[model samples]
Target: MFKNLKNDLPASIVVFFVALPLCLGISVASGAEPITGLIAGIVGGIIVGAASGSKIGVSGPAAGLAVIVATAIGNLGYENFLVAVVLAGVFQIILGVFKAGIIGYYFPSSVIKGMLTGIGIVIILKEIPYFFGIDKNPEGDFAFLQVDGENTLTELLKVINALISGNFDYGATIIAVIAMAILLLWGNVLSKKGKFFQLVQGPLVAVVIGIVYYFLTKDSGLELSKDHLVSVPIPDGLSGLKDLLTFPDFSALTNPKIYITAFTIGLVASLETLLCVEATDKLDPNKNVTPTNRELFAQGSGNIVSGLIGGLPVTQVIVRSSANIQSGGKSKASAVIHGFFLLISIVTIPTVLNLIPLSVLAAILFIVGYKLAKPSTFKAMYDSGWMQFVPFITTIVGIVFIDLLWGIGLGLAVGIFIVLYKSFGNSHFLHKEGENVDDGKIKMTLAEEVTFFNKASILKELDQLPENSFLELDVRKTRYLDNDIIEILEDFAFKARERNIDIKLISERGIIENPDSFIEFFKLKKPTE
Candidate 1:
């Protein structure tokens, strides 16, 4: 654990910076106290991160949960929401017990890649507000658009209005710009040198600068600006702690809606986690495989704790987890350590956290978004194969135009369509190369069950057989043939009479089903030849 701790601590700090804004944003978007996001992050990091089997996956409250969380809070009240979270955790654990984690593995490579790139595109679109000092919600959109607006473009306009009217705070903008500058410098310049500078990460730098910026603002007696800063609730020592606790309503468990809600959240969160894990692995220079089942179990544990503590349910979120791996996280320990940092920061210095600028975090996420949906990513996908390129590109567009799940579903459906079309059209269903004559005879083998789709190739093969040559149609292995093929055979037999062609059926049992004409044309029952 110590060895693991060594590697995870640095990675954890990077993850912590990435995670902090997200925690606040998701909670605010969910209509819950921003502190709830921190609670979820703490549970996700400490319980899920520590218990998780994935070596590098970092857990936290997911933006994907914002819709459900918001809806649940509105419909069931916040206390009842806790019950759903616990129930969702239980379902996730059940999924883990049955080894349903493999479901993630079954998704096509194209679909998974598509899902990640799509999420990246959505992140980029949604974060435009924060980047420009526009504060709607950091990055939460379900069907499309935000609660206060429609589309990223509309939100940007709102931000412009906020900025021009002297409504937007300038202090955070200044700090955010500096944080971004430091972030850029850290990744591009400072990281190259194997010196004291390399030891410090950019997000950490942004965080430190944010603290100083806050101090400067506070000392100057500037007006409070939630827009310019991280706005998560910070309890004042013991009293704030008391206000945060909540008890679940057991009666809510009796609501069937709770179960449906639980399943939807559990299933979606798990899928998002798996998608992030796959994308993160690809981003890894080492190219390691993640244990998906263990990840589900870990997420389940986190959700359970999160629910108990009045936090939103958690998952292996890619935005932060990817940052961890990119920052050179050596193991899951990094993820676990980050959880501790979140807990300590909230418990000891949440007031300071509120001081950190949202713009700084936006800059960090912008970097992440760029990495995910880089122009090069599209080029690389195009180069890889159509099986990958189509779904990946479509997923990005779909996700951007719609939401996370819809985009993934659309891309996956297209991918499956391609797979099935290829499966049934030619490769496995028909034997083409074998149709050429062998010593004046052609043999065509029928699959165990021949459907109407087999008619084209079968008829084409029959037509190609030499006018005077013998053709052996084997149905011994076949159990069923569609009527379309039977009709084609019946028509061909009539043609054979004029062409002096010899057609033979080789089967242990006589033909039981065919066109009525075909049945009458071959009147001899069971000609045992």
Candidate 2:
């Protein structure tokens, strides 16, 4: 892993710069202490990076889980939420052991795109209040409803009111605009100018500028207060640092809600990790495919360690992983090195870190959100046709109006329905050219895979055949013929005889003229067991 120090070492610094603001920003978004995000970043890098199969994939506190973490903390309390993170690690370990990493493949691409877009929209909405400097408990809940008797839309309304009344924080707003402008210019323009610009990310620059802005504008009307800046509790020494660490509340083990939150975190984290792993592998110059089950185990271990020390849930994050790859990372050593950087920064520069404006972080997240939900993405999905567009749109609306899980669930439900509907219509092919209209003969070829879902379509075709017809039932290409379908054919054989219809059954085994029963024919030699 350390063989490529010349390349990996430099790449690690770039990844560190990329991950720093994200860790802190996601923490604030998740309603957790800033230190918790840093802790998760540390564990995810050192522990998960060590255990992961991928040579370059980076792990950290993910923005995708910000909404869930925030809601969980609000509902279960931070201590109880820690218990969930621990249990979530256990669940992820179980999923890895059971080789359930393939679960990620079952989700339709449309649904996944929808999930990302929905989360992106929510992030933009939640961060707007902070961007405008109306920082009222910037816990960053993305849910439509909040515990403070206000919801996302209501809060947005308040921001509009603040704007109309000219009562917003001018200082924070100014910093945010500058920070955003820098991020935009750095990412879109400067980064293309040279390698130095690529190695030094926009978020880090925005954060440093925000700190400088805070110090320079102190005591002025445009000065941002502590509430508008990051709030990292400074530790005095070794003992003080240890005192800052929080442990899971074991008493919460008896609480069912803790288990529910754990399962949600585990499931969602696993999904996100698997998706990032796939994307990172694609981005790899060597095109290496990480062992997904091993990746799950590594993430599980990271989350366990992170939770034990008051950190948000950890997952393989695409942003950090992509930055690592683009910066010439050649091995996991880069990831481990980045973790040490995070640790050193917190230990040596807590005061400087605390000066970073929350508005600046909000601006960084604004770019993140925009990338996830680009207007072109929606247009492309719409162009993909209704099969893809329906579930995609459904998921976005569900996520915007409801919660993260509900949105994915609704999208999956719609996807499944669409699949079933198509399955029902495509049960078999009745060859037009093969039809002997003068003799009332029909040749029907069964689909490659016919399940019970195809029963209605197949039955309708069979019933519509003319009386005294010669039916040629072909199953040569059928790899899977469900028992339900066999039974349907068995029943139809009896009706065919009464209607004076002669049935010819063709299979890989042989051809049977007027088969007495399909159940007995295919039952003895099923195409696929």
Candidate 3:
């Protein structure tokens, strides 16, 4: 990993700028102290990044978990909630040990893509208001309906109304517009100039310019207040930083609600981490696969440490991961370095960080969001067929209209339904060679894998056979035949005898004549073997 520091160091710096604001925003949105988010970011980067098998995935406090964390904190109180988070980490470790990471494989590719796209749409929706200088909701709230009594679409409308009525903050709007322009130009042009330009990053430049703009407009009507800027808790000194950390309350372990909350956090965090691992692998230029089980273990460890030290739950977040990838991260070192940046920044220059505008960060996120949910992505998925497109579209709709988990659930349901439908129709193929039923010449070719899903179709075909029919049952191509199908064929053989039907079973082991039982005949050992 150290071999690629030339690339990794620069990528780490870019990810640091991207992660800093998000850490602060997510903490405030989660109903936790802002410092807690920074702690999670620090641990997720240094601990989880070092421990994780993934080379490119970046873990942090995710906007996806903001709702769950907020609700849990409100119910259990901060200290009690920290206990739940720690227990959740324990549960995740257990899951990793049991190899439950295999659950990640069960999700269809279409649904996964839909998830990325859905999250992109959510980010764009959530950030648009901020970009336009409308800041009613907190920065990291990414749900369809926010805790502030405004939904995604309604919030967009409110931004439009505010703009029309001239109630928006001009300082934020001007800075945000200029920052976005700088980012676009840097990405499209200046970044190509040299390694130095690439390493510096457009977002950092945008932020610096935004701060300067803020200072320049201090006494003007276009001035932005502290509320419109990044708000990391600034300590008076190194000693004051110690007061920000809050440990979990062990006494809450006896509460049943704590157990429920733990399970919820563990399940959600594991799922989010697994999905992120999959997406990150897709984004990796090297196409290296991350060990899903090991990732769970790493995240579990990070969360445990984070909780003990008063941090929100951590997961492999796609936003930060994507930023790392886009910034040319070559290894896990980039993620680890980003964490150190978070730690050092909070310890050293937090007061300076406070001067950065939220609008500048929103512009950066807008670019990230747009890239994830690009129009090209939709077109590509649509071209893949309805089998792929339906689940993909369903996931997007569900996520936009409902919540993240619900959207994924709905997409998975649709994907499963499609698989079942195809299975039912593809059980077997029937071919009739002879014209007359009296002659009774029929051939039934079984599918490569015949399952219980094909039971009804096979049974119906058997019942339709004419009396005194000659039937050929072909299983030469079959690799697996379900017990249900075997039983159906067995019962049909008995009925065939009563109808004076002659049966010949042809398989890989040659032919069976008047088999007493389909199961026994198929299971019989071959002489050559």
The digit string of per-residue lDDT tens for model 1 on 300-366 reads 8888888887888898887787788788887888888888898888778877777766777777887
What are the lDDT scores of the predictions, listed in order? 0.72, 0.80, 0.84
Candidate 1, position 390, lDDT? 81
Worst 10 residues of 1 by lDDT: 520-529
User: Which residue segments of model 1 deviate by more than 4 Å?
Assistant: 136-143, 159-171, 214-226, 238-242, 425-529
Among these predictions, the greatest TM-score belongs to 3
lDDT over C-alpha atoms for residue 496 of model 1? 74
Better of 2 and 3 by TM-score: 3
TM-score of each: 0.76, 0.71, 0.80
Tens digit of per-residue lDDT, candidate 2, span 117-190:
88778778878988988955654455566546678888889999999999999999999999999988987899
Worst 10 residues of 3 by lDDT: 520-529
lDDT tens per residue, model 3, 112-135: 789989988888888888887787
Instruction: Summing lDDT over every window of 10 consecutive residues in candidate 2, give the lowest-scoring window.
Output: 424-433
